[model samples]
Target: MWFERPPGVPDWSEAESYLRRADPALGAVIDRVGPCTLAPRRDYFVVLCKAIFTQQISTAVATTLFGRFRDLFPNRRPTPARVIEVLGRADPAVLRGCGLSRQKTSYLADLAQHLADGRIPTRRLAGMDDEAVIEALVGVRGIGRWTAEMFLIFTLNRPDVFPVGDLGVVDGLRDVFNLPARPTPAEALALGERWRPYRSIATWYLWRRGSVPVAAPAVPVPDAVAGAPPCARRRRPRPAAAPGAAISPARPRAQK
Candidate 1:
């Protein structure tokens, strides 16, 4: 279940109204998707870790690997101490076997050390503004602007964040606006200005629009024993032909 919006959160509708008054294109999209609220997620550490895991990977694969990592330490989410405890003595190959790249493993370990040494407190970031949060997060190795922006949107649930560097957002703009070519990140930032404070919600919708739904796995049938009769396979029925393709009862059938 999703967490409810905290009390006194800014009204998205009002933001939408402001954007609509600013640009017709943004207003049109807002009209279509309607009001959107921030989708709350787990705390900073988990979100950052997951984001690191998901870098340059498909969502399905990332989800599977993240699940496996969680199973390794049941009930407790990955914390700084837990990361150090599990990874300090564990072989690098073992972490790599969990689908983490060597660079990511090193980066995560560095992050854990920073957290453990009181260099950065996860809780202290909450009260800071977006820029400040980004500044602090990117101070750690391997954490970039895109990762920090994700932390802002997913973990902090900040009202305004537009990751102009995101490829999906750029593609979304091209597809939605019917542009001949994809815009550069700079161009995307300029275009995103129209969305303003509700850019986070707009970005969420853009991602949702471009994401392909994952198909469920197919169930396997049991193999037949040595003496057992083979089970019949079931097939889906085809749809009936339309009027033009239908055969008339009055017409004589042609022999094959």
Candidate 2:
């Protein structure tokens, strides 16, 4: 598991049982994928910053870069103030030396600034609902809806989120239903409502659905069923998906 399971997260045992009952196809996936492993870190700033470092990079590469990133601060913790101080420097060579791309550096700076200025008040997130948390996270420069949704699921452990634009979700859903083409965002949204408040758990299983044979998927896999892991279907990210934008909570309901 990338993160250690925090004590406050949902009851894995109960969630699995509920999900198994709510979504049978997903239940098969859960049986194949094994236990839910969503252990979230408590530090909001660090999670978002590391998310920036991880953008568009391989896992080994991201690991190396994050290690170098940790070297910049004492006790290996890049607190908001410490990161802000580093970004504020005229040269900022120390930060760039971590092998982060220029765009990623800018992203880190923006996130740190958000935390420092209270644009993203980490302390208040626990009290905020899912949409509110997404809004606050996407307000930071260089972050978009995909990142915010991931933060909601993986970091905050919000159980109901359904990231329709995520390739894993799309691919997983496609395979589960044996669809001829990938479902659009709106289509996925409609299909997902059956899972309701447990959609996040359903999503976790869907992410790994590609790796397992669907319990009762029909014969002859479609072109759309090509194996793939769930990531932002827009792997890097897409624009914000919020109420004010020309978008829904999922990706803008794109035309097929």
Top-scoring candidate (lDDT): 2
Name the weakest run of 10 consecutive residues (lDDT summed) in model 2: 240-249
- Global local distance difference test of model 2: 0.70
lDDT tens digits by residue: candidate 1, 1-256: 1234456654566666776676554455455444555556646677777766776666678788887776667485788888878877777677776787877787788788877786667668778889988887787777877778877886677868987667667655554444445666655665566667778866765664422211111222123311222211322322322322311111112111
TM-score of each: 0.70, 0.78
lDDT of 1: 0.62
Error of 2 at 89 (Å): 2.7
Error of 2 at 81 (Å): 1.1
Indicate the worst ten consecutive residues by lDDT in candidate 1: 247-256
Question: In model 2, what is the error at residue 58, expressed in angstroms?
Answer: 1.8
C-alpha lDDT of residue 140 in model 1: 75
TM-score top scorer: 2
Off by over 4 Å in 1: 1-11, 91-93, 209-256
What is the lDDT for 153 in model 1? 80
Candidate 2 C-alpha lDDT tens digits along 84-143: 787677365766678666777777888888888998988899789999998898887677
lDDT of each: 0.62, 0.70
